[model samples]
Target: MTAPVAKLLLKVFTYRQLAVGGGFLAGFGYVYCGIGFALSALPGYIILEDHFQDQFPKALSASSLFNFIGIAVLPPLLQYLKTLFGSREAFILFGAVTWHMIPAGFGLRDAVPRGGCIDRPSVSKRHAKTKRDLKFVNKYLSFCSCLFYHKNYAILVVTEFLSSLIYISWALFLVSLGTSAGLREESAVILSTAAGVGSFLGTALAIGLFHFQKMNAYTSCAVPLLVNGIGLVGLTFARDFNSLLSLTLLTGFCLGVNISGMIGIIPSLVCRYHFQQAVVINYFIDGIAYQFGGLISGAIRDLYGSTLYVYGFAALLSFVALPWILIWACNKDPNRECEPDLS
Candidate 1:
C-alpha cells in the first residue's frame, strides 16, 4: 500500500527531499509490510497447523520458490524498464502495476480454524486497573518487554539479528567484491542471478527433504547457517569470476534454507496467539538490522579500502549466531504441540 504512494511521491520531490521522503517512506513501508505479513501469515499458519501440521515445513519451502523467482527476475526486469522509460516514469509504471495488490488482497479468504482456543478476553476489562495505575506509553513498553522475556523468543531475536546483519552486509558488498576481483558489471549481475537460481534450488531441496526424509528444523536451520558462514569466508579468498559466482550461489542456497526453516519452525515455537506478535517483532528487528548492516559495511569498506575484511567480519558474525540457535534447538521439545487458535 505505501509502496505506490512512495513511488508517486518520488516523482514530485526534488533529489534532496526525495532522499528524506524516501527514507521515511521506506521505513514506514517496512513497518506496514511487517504488520501486513504477520496478519496474512497468521491465518495460513493456523490452517497449516490444524490440517497439515506434519507437512508444514515442506509447504513453507514450496511457498518460498516464488520469492526466489522474484529475486532472480525483478532486478533485470526493473533495469530494462528504467532504460526504456526513464527512472521516474518507470517507477510510476511499476507503482501502477503494484496497485493490483489492493484488489488481490481483497480476494483472500478467511482461514481461521474451526475449533481453537484464543485468550482474547476483553482488553479494556482486563487492563482497566492497570491502565489506571500506568500511562499508555508505560503499558506499551511493558507489553513489548514481556515479548523478549520468553527464552525461545529471546534466542530467536538474537539469532535473527545476527543473521540479518551478516546477510545484508554481504548482499550490499557482493557486487563491489566482484568488481574488485576484475569481473565485468554484467558478470556480477549474472553472479547475482546465479545466486537466485541456487536459492530456488535450495528451497526445492528443503521441500523434498521435508516431505521425503523428514528433516528436522534444527538441521534445516543450523546447516544453512554453517554453510553461509563458510561461503562468506570463501568469498574473502575468491579472486576470479567463477570462484565468486560459485560462492555467491552457495551463500544464496544457504540463505534460502535459513529463511524457509526459520519461518517453517515458528509454529513449533509459540502459541497461535503469540505468533503474530513474534513474527512482527522479528520483522521489525530484521529491518533495523538490514539498515545497520548496510551502514556498517559501507563504513568498513570506505575505511579499509577492501571488501575482504568486511566479508571476514560478516562471516564471524554468522558464526556467532550458531551457539544461540543450537542452545534453543537443544532445549526445544521436538514433539511439543501448539495451542491452535483463530485469533
Candidate 2:
C-alpha cells in the first residue's frame, strides 16, 4: 500500500464500503444464489472498489434504494399475508394454487408457433451479422476503461485484487487447517458454521465502531487483517480442532466486519451515474486476482507441506494494501464535514 492509500482508508474507505454493501447484497443476489446452484458454493460475498462511488452515485443509489425497500418490505409482506389469511396453511396453499394457475392461464392463451419459410441467409452474410454485433458491444464496453486511470479507481482495483488473492487461499486452507488438527468433516462444518454465526456478530460490532468514530474504514480493515493474520499464524503451531475453530471464528468475524464496512463505503465516494460501471470493474479486478491465487496456492502447497510460508504470504499481501490507504488519508484535510449517505 502507498501512503495516500493508507490515509484514504482511515478517512474515506469505510463509509464508501458501507454505501456499496447496501446495494451489493441485493443487486448481487443473482450472483450469490444462481452461482451456488451452478458451482460449488463458497461461504463468502463480493466487495466493490471504493473509488467507483466517486463516479457513479445515481446508479448506485438506485440499486441500493431498491435493496433497502426489499429488505424493509419482504418479511412484513409475507407475514401480513399469513396473518390476513389466518394461517400458514392457507397462505401457502393459495400461493401454490396461484403458481400453477397463473402459468396454466398463460399456457391456455399461448399461440403456438406457425411454420414459416426459412429466413436463413448465406454463410458469408451470417458471419457478417455476428461480427457487427460483437464489434458494437465491445466498442461500448471499452468506454468503461475511463475508470482505470483515476487514483481512487486504482485503490479499489488493488484492494479487490489483494483481498481475492488472500481469500481464495484462506478459504480452502481453512478446511485443512481444521482437519489436520484432528477435526472430522462434521467438526469442520460446525466450525465453519460458527464462523458464519460470527459474521452477523461482526456486523453488529461495526455499528458500534462507527458510532465511536467517523468512517474509520481503513482501520476497520486493518483490525481484521491483523486479527486474521495472527489467528492463522497461530494455527501453524496449534495442535487441536477447538483452537482452530476459535481462530476460524475470529477470522470470520473480521471478514464479516470487512464486508459490512466495505459495502457501506463504496457508494459514498463515487457519483451515482458511474455506479454500474464501477461495480462491473470491481468484479473484474477480483476475478483476475483470484485466478492468480488459485495457481499460486496449488503450486505452493504441492511444493511444500501445510506450512507457515503460504499463510504468511497471504497475510503479507493484505499488508500491501494498508500503506496505500494510510497515504490516502494523510493528504486529505482533517476537518471537513462528511458527505451524506456514506455512513
Best by lDDT: 1
Which tens-of-lDDT digit does each residue in 288-322 have in candidate 1?
89878988987888899998889998989978888
TM-score of each: 0.74, 0.54
What 10-residue stretch in candidate 1 is worst by lDDT? 334-343
What is candidate 2's lDDT per residue for 165-187, written digit by digit as tens?
Answer: 87677655665666666777545
Question: What's model 1's TM-score?
Answer: 0.74
The global Cα lDDT (0 to 1) of model 1 is 0.71
C-alpha RMSD in Å of predicted model 2 compared with the true structure? 20.3
Position 289, candidate 1: lDDT? 91
